[model samples]
Target: MLTISAKEMKDVLYELFKKYEFTESKANLLAEVFTQNTLYGVNSHGINRVPYFIETVKKGIVKVNEEAKKIEAFGNIERWDGNQGPGIINAVTCTNRAIALAKKDGMGLVALRNTNHWMRGGYYGWQAAKENCIAILFTNTQPNMPAWGGKESRIGNNPFVVSIPRKEGHIVLDMALSQFSFGKINNYKLKGEQLPYHGGWDEDHKLSKNPENILKTEQGLPIGYWKGSAFSIVLDMLATLLSAGNSTYKIGLKEHETAISQVYLCIYPEIFHDQDLQHTLINEIINYTHDVTPSEKGERTYYPGERAANAEKHNSKNGMKVNKEIWQKVLSLL
Candidate 1:
């Protein structure tokens, strides 16, 4: 493992992205987003994923310097075409548009089609929270998980995120429908560790904690078994219909996962309710959750985004420990 500073990580990423023909502003934004994800303890989607992102760019699956263009509008709701740009850049653009619309109206919704994989959905949620807006967002991925009671992979383990602004720290819930995302599984595999729990089905169609077996089958376990499968289906339907974009099945036909659909919805709570009351209510809920009886001795309960916030603090002061092999690969991109 290697302990690297956040600034150093960002500087390397910026230089690498610039080599990919990304403009100065875009490179900087991409660098910060990737580095921030790592600092927040989500190495599965952070530095570890940079090399794969560059591969997609090289294969012409992801275009450089392309921005989302508005397709249609309806009052506070709008649809945009991502133009197959960098997922992070397109996601940021759509999120800002949603926030701007929410400020103008009471609520705003942006449906984005033809976008690539947004590395970490929570990044956009935090973006909205920083603007003091409540945000709910989700994105579809390539078909990677099977439906309930099915052997064939036919569903996407789409991610969902929600963020509520707070003075002390934002509350964000970001999760994939699968019990373990592919990235997380891969990370565990790289570390030669087993999952804490059964993460997916092995080739024998049995639940397993071995990441290698699960990845071979590509049959990740749904979060709630049947219930999670249903949630993934509905989210996929909503995203595809709203954005008028490719569905999971359609994306499965592509060589790689690209041109997916996503939705970003933001609400301006202060415009409707008292800010003080909102904060009080939020704090009460968090306190109540924290005060719950511990499931394990000597372990404290945490709210949705609490652990990540703490990780960001500690990692900023100290440094993030990353896999040496992956770190070397990222550096080689230069």
Candidate 2:
């Protein structure tokens, strides 16, 4: 492992993106998001994924210069076509647009179609929450998990995010339907570490923490067994129908995962006029959860976003730790 300062990392990524034909602004935005993902301890979507993103760009799968376009608008709701633009740029634009609409109305909705992988959905959640708005975001991926009863892959690990604003640290929940993302499992494998909890089944159909087997089978367990499976189906349905875009099952048929669907929602507190009450309620919930008796000595409970935020602070100050080989690979690209 090696540590790289955030500025240095961002500069390297920016230069690389620019060299690949991204506009200066777009390159900066992409670099910033990737850097922040690493800082937040989401290397699976950060530096670890950069090489793949560059490869996609080189393959012309992700158009470097394309921009999303508004397809339609109805009051507080709008629809847009990503036109196969880089997912990070499209997602950030849509989230900002949703926030703007929410500022005028009580809430806003933006359904996006034909986008690529957003890479860490929580980035947009935190973006909205930071502006003192509640948000819900959803994205569908290529089929990577099987339906509850079936064997072959037929559903996405579709990730969803929810966030509530707070003066201290906004409460955010960013999770996928799968127990562990393929990126996460691969990261653990690369680090020669076992998953902290059961993540998927082995070839023999037994629960296993070995990521290699999970990757080979491409059959990840959902977070809550059947419940998560059901949620994944519903989320894929909603994104597809609402955006009038391809579902995970449809995307799986393509050569690569692109032109996917997503939705962003934002709610402003001013419309509710109960800011204090909302904060109090959130505090009560968080405190109650932490108040639970530890199942083991020295064990501590954490809310959804707490751990990520802690990781962000530590990594930002100490520098992001990267796999030595991967770092070298990225440098070689430059």
Candidate 3:
């Protein structure tokens, strides 16, 4: 493990991206997002995935130069064709566009089709919240998990995000349908550590913390059990239908996960007369959750997004930790 300042890491990533023909603006934006993800303690989606992202670009699965094009527009909704562009850039653009629309209308929606994987969906949620807008976003992925009661992989562990703006810190919930994402499980396995909670089932169909067995079986348990499975199905359907793009089941037919669909929705509070009431209600809900007795002594319970904010502070002061091997590989790309 090695620790590097966020600025240094961002510069390194920018240099590497430039080597791949990304323009300065695009490179800087990508680098900043990646660095922020690491700074917020999401290594599984940050530096750990940068190497594969580069590989995807090299493989021609992700178009480095392609920009999303607006395909259709409604009163407060729009559809875009990503043209297989880099997912992070496309997602950020769409999220911003949604916020712009919400500024005019009370609500805005954007559906993007034919995009690559958007590492760390929470980034866009944070983007919207920064603008004082509520956001809901979803992305489809390659089928890596089975439907409920089935044995074969048939559903995407599609990630979803929600964010509500607040003065202190935005309340954001970013999670995949699966109880554990493969990237997260692999990270634990690499560290030879057990999961803090039950993540998945083994080949013997028993709950297990052994990431290796879970990976081999590909039988990840869904969060909230059947509820998450149902939610995944609905989210996949909504993304595909709204974007008029391929569903997770269709994407699974291919060896690589590309040409995925995503949706972003933003709502502005200024248009509503009850904005103050809504804000108060949100705070009340958060306070209620925090008031619960923690399972461990001296461990204060936190609302969603609390840990990320704390991580940002600690990482900014102490430098972000990076896996030595991954960092070297990223440098090699430069």
Candidate 4:
């Protein structure tokens, strides 16, 4: 295991990205996003995945300098095409644009089509929440899990994120339809550890914590069995139809996952209600939730994004724990 300070991580990765032909500004943005994810303890989507991301660029799956193009504008809602650009940049651009529209019109809806994987979907949630706006977003991926009863992979996990601003801390929920993300499973597999919960089924069709078995069988369970299966289908529908882009079914036909669809929504609470009233309500809701008795003796309940914020603070102070192998791979990039 190894650890690196956030400043070093960002500076090193920024230069590495520039070596790959990314513009200095774009490289800086990408490096910051990746570093932020690591700082927040989401290594599955952070520095841990940078090697593969760079490989995708080398393979031409992600156009290094491509920028998204606006397709149409309707009131506060707009559509964009990613043009196979870096997903993180496209998503950030759309998120900022959504917030800008909300600032002007009280709300904004942006749909992006033909985009690549956005990496950490929750990044945008935090992005909007920091601006004191409500945000909701989701993206469809290639078919990686089965639809409900059928054994064949028919739908994507479809990550979803929602963020609400609060004086104490932003409330952010980042989740997938599945009980565990493939990235989580891969991390467990790498560490040779068992999942604390039943994550998926084995090749023999029995529930298992062995990540390798789940990966081989591709039997990752949904959040609520059938319910998550159905929810994923609905999210996929919205992303595809709203963005006028590739559906999960069509993405399954591709050689690689690209041209995915995503949606970004932002609402300015000050426009709809007084800031004081919003804070009061937020406090009331949080306090009531906190009053609930703990099911575990040592565990305290935290709002979705609270843990992430806490992790960021801790990692920032102590430096980030990183897999030594992945760290070595990243160094080789330089």
Which residue pairs does candidate 1 place in steric collision? none
Any idea what lDDT model 3 has?
0.90
Name the lDDT of candidate 4.
0.91
- Candidate 1 per-residue C-alpha lDDT over 1-334 given as tens digits, one digit per residue, 9 for 90 to 100: 9999999999999999999999999999999999999999999999999999999999999999788999999999999999999999999999999999999998999999999999999999999999999999999989889899998899999999999999999999999999998999999999999999999888888999999999999898999999999999999999999999999999999989999999999999989668888888999989888887887889889888899999999999999989999999998889
lDDT of 4 by residue, 153-184 (tens): 78888999999988889999999888998888
Candidate 4: segments with Cα more than 4 A from true spot: none
Predict model 1's lDDT versus the native: 0.95
- lDDT string, candidate 3, 117-180, tens digits: 9899999999999999999999988877777888677787899999989987898888988988
What are the clashing pairs of model 2? none
1 against 4, candidate with superior lDDT: 1
Better of 2 and 3 by lDDT: 2
TM-score-wise, the better of 3 and 4 is 4
Instruction: Give the whole-model CA lDDT for all candidates, comma-separated.
Output: 0.95, 0.91, 0.90, 0.91
- State the displacement of the C-alpha of residue 223, model 1, in Å, after optimal TM-score superposition: 0.8
Tell me the spans in candidate 3 whose CA falls farther than 4 Å from its real position.
203-206
Q: Write model 2 residue lDDT over 189-277, tens digit each, in one string.
A: 99999999988878887778999988888888887888998999999999998889999988999999999999999999878788889
In model 2, how large is the Cα lDDT of residue 50?
A: 94
Select the stronger candidate by lDDT from 3 and 4: 4
Residue 266, candidate 2: alpha-carbon lDDT: 97
Among the numbered candidates, top lDDT falls to 1
